[model samples]
Target: MKKLTTLRTKVFAAVMLTIATVAATAQTNGSGRLVKQDRDLPGFTEIEAGSAFSIKVSQGDDIKVTVETDDNYLDKIETVVKGDRLHIASMGMKNPSAMRVYIRMPELKTLDISGAARIETDGGITGTTLEIIASGASKVKLDLNVELLNSKVSGASKAEFNGNASVHRSEISGAANLNALNLKTLTTNARVSGAGKASIFARDEITADLSGAGALSYYDNGQLNKISKPGTLTFTPQNPGSGPSEEISASVEATDAGDSTIVKIGDIKVSVREGNPTKITIGGSELEVDDNGNVNFKRKKQTRFDGHWGGFELGVNGYVNKDRQFDMPEGYEFLDLRMEKSVNVKLNFYEQNFNLISNKFGLTTGLGFEWNNYRFDNNVVLLKDGNDLINDNFLYARNYNKSKLVVNYLNLPLLLEYQTNRFSKKNSFHIGAGLQTGLRIGSHTKLVYQDDGRKKKDKDPGDYHINPFKYDLMVRVGWGKLNLHANYSLNTLFKNNRGPELYPFTIGIALVSW
Candidate 1:
């Protein structure tokens, strides 16, 4: 048994290592100058700027950016710190994103930047190297491209490419959403995330290789040519609906375009790339994937079956750190202080594979019913004293509670999952992630307080139902079937509510696994 566990660990490690190697080889870095990075987070790292926007590279360096209050600016760096080996992540969460650093990077070898970086490379793609390394947090975005050197991305990496991308060979995390049209080379790796499509082209000498977990999808609309490397390809095709077609457009390739890339697909996979596809015309609706799109397995509504013995879960989790700059509402003549609260939760069908996704880390995906939500409420004291109560927003405004923030949703989500020790019995673990299309199941508010606080009338915040589709991240750590867990709602707490963006997170013990 111990040997089996060790083997599982080894296999899992090997899989992740392969992915990292693939992403790393596909990234880009140039010149040998260290430009400052502008961290967009309120508590993230900053970037340095350059005068002429020259290219600079660095190997092995670490930087930390703390985005604090009252200060958000950008600057450029002219030099790269020599001999630094760690990467300080640049979070891209704010607007007017800019930061300047004082550093130098001359004759550097490699450059690495991770975390949420709103990166804009002014210089052209030259002798630059790019890669995704080990990370604990999950990231997801669209419309950015990292030069692929070797990629071992475990978090969500997404972007759209209008230009051609050049890559050697790299692995992609199931969370990576890449859509590029101009054909080029994509050396094989593991899973590709999302429902987005791109025109894939490999040099005739290059082959489309795939390994590791998740479903495989290969489809196109051209001369479905013969695969050169037949032995390297694998597949077992099964289409539930009118999803996967029989052919893909052939790209003009060199003689060694290897064999027809084989596709080894699991359940829940679809592939459609570029141009209106030829298909049977039925019911006046063209039965084909076009700019209108097809090869998509989108259920108008996918709910649970009765007697499935599955219900849903509700959660509330979030943090209320002390607001350094407390901006009271307009014309508030009185105010008070108290600890804040953040509420977040994931209520999914209990007895279903969806429950198998315990968002304890990174991202995850599944199909089931869910009513997940989160929010934040200030720990408010109506006034520091009765003297300040007259002008306070909490005290004077009769419609203040009406401004209370609430965000709830009913949704169908596409998720990506990254686990740490999923294959081990002694220390196996899983994290749940995925998007949710929460149809407003129900919403209610409570006025919670301890007797140590002052007395007030028992007023319910009333009920509200808003349509919100949300993405969630949850991390759980445990052995076997039981784990300690917390879920954080990644969406704003209120869409139409009249308050600040409130995020809710919930924590609880769960019996979950991959």
Candidate 2:
């Protein structure tokens, strides 16, 4: 019986030894040098990182992770998935500058970060709810489009936010700071303590509680209720203080000066001179009332213009054939696009306007970047055969989950713009039409699929016979803050006779403007 027990013990020890050998071989090659590695992990909705590493998260259909680091430290990083949470940390190393981790999942519900780790999202995160918790002097930045956002910052951590949200609730303590003035929310509730500072934007209602030496700044004209104790509160230009905190004396006076009757009310002064004009001066600004009882704000005599070219735009991309039809005319069905998936993005970074007639009409010019994606509807890929693009379906063993072609251009536009109001941006109607020219900067094709239960992405960048230069007629129309833009190509998508004779166009609304 003793011999039998001893035999079982030896077998158990051998199994443990074999498992350790396999794990060590997987982390390094025969040379004992560590290398870059990818970990196949189960689905997780929560992430917890406790190290000083650069982490980027994005939305995807499946969970994927790629860890890039120096060969010496590859074996020291640890990624463990337990339950519905993924914990990332380093065993003993501290602040490895060569480490970068890219993580993607279908959705994310919660993120917890400690230490000095820096985390960011690749694009806007849209979901029902998102919760962010940061401590230990960490940093987090996200572009959010969510229904509800809950953020907590402590221990000198900092968080930056942009995009839009329906409601936001945040708590800051210690010396932490929350900078969310660019995140437009419908309603907000915030609490600050210790020496933390918070800046937020709200549209409808805001309720805040402040204590200690913390400060709060908000961009909203909505209803506000605050409980302030030693902390300072500030208002941004989107909404200003309605009245003075303390009551002050007021007076009115009238006088006559050289055939002009002058009336003074508070800081406003009105001057009415016969056979001239009725002018009102408030501080340094001047307003003139014409014969028709129209009050117009006098502007500088220099060339005045209202430009509508600088903004961020999003739209769908499409191409029409030679006959101006979307339907492919036989032998060209491969170029067909999935309209909903083909996207166009424009970032108008700079703009200038020169007035031609008052502020109503002006010549506008701007610099922008145009990113166009053509997602294919069929299960095929475009291959460059000489100078022409041909369709092929034999490159992959499995069907791709997503396939798309991307083109980027540096764009310059010259437009004639008109505005209905000079300075009343809230009530103005604007229209701009112009010619836009673009220089193609880059092009690529991307494919995503599953290989043996693992998600994989393949990117191939090449010219693909795309036109080097493009010209388009552009139009922009908007009322108040809502703007819509459209573009129609004046030339074929590809060089003459190189590919299908298709003209690309886009129509979308401006998501943001200045």
Q: lDDT per model, in order?
A: 0.33, 0.77
In candidate 1, what are the lDDT values of residues 1-514, reduced to their tens digit?
3463355346434543443354355533322332344343222122322122222222123333322211332221222222344233223323222333322222222333343333333222232444433221222121223345443443333332322235634344433433333323334332332211112333322333433222233323322233322124533322222212322333332224453222223222223333435343222232345565554322222132111111123233332212312233333312211112232333332222332333223333333343333222233323222222222344533332211233445444444434454333334444444444455555544333434354443333333322245555544443444545545656644443333344444455432222
TM-score of each: 0.30, 0.48
Write candidate 2's Cα lDDT for 1-514 as tens digits.
3463355346434543443343354442223333568889889999999777889999888899888776667778888898989999887654344567889988888999988789999976778999999996689999888899999998657899888888899999766889887787877888887657788777667767788656687643442333446644433334442322122334544444567677876567788877767988876578999777888886433336767876667777778778776766456677767766888998765566788887788899867778999988777677888767777866654588888999999898999988998766557899889999999999999988888899999899989889999999998888876777788999998887678889998877765565
Find the 10 residues in a row with the least total lDDT in model 1.
302-311
Error of 1 at 32 (Å): 32
lDDT of 1: 0.33
**Candidate 2 clashes between residue pairs 3 or more apart in a chain or in different chains:** none
Q: Candidate 1, TM-score vs. the true structure?
A: 0.30
* Segments of candidate 2 deviating more than 4 angstroms: 1-280, 283-303
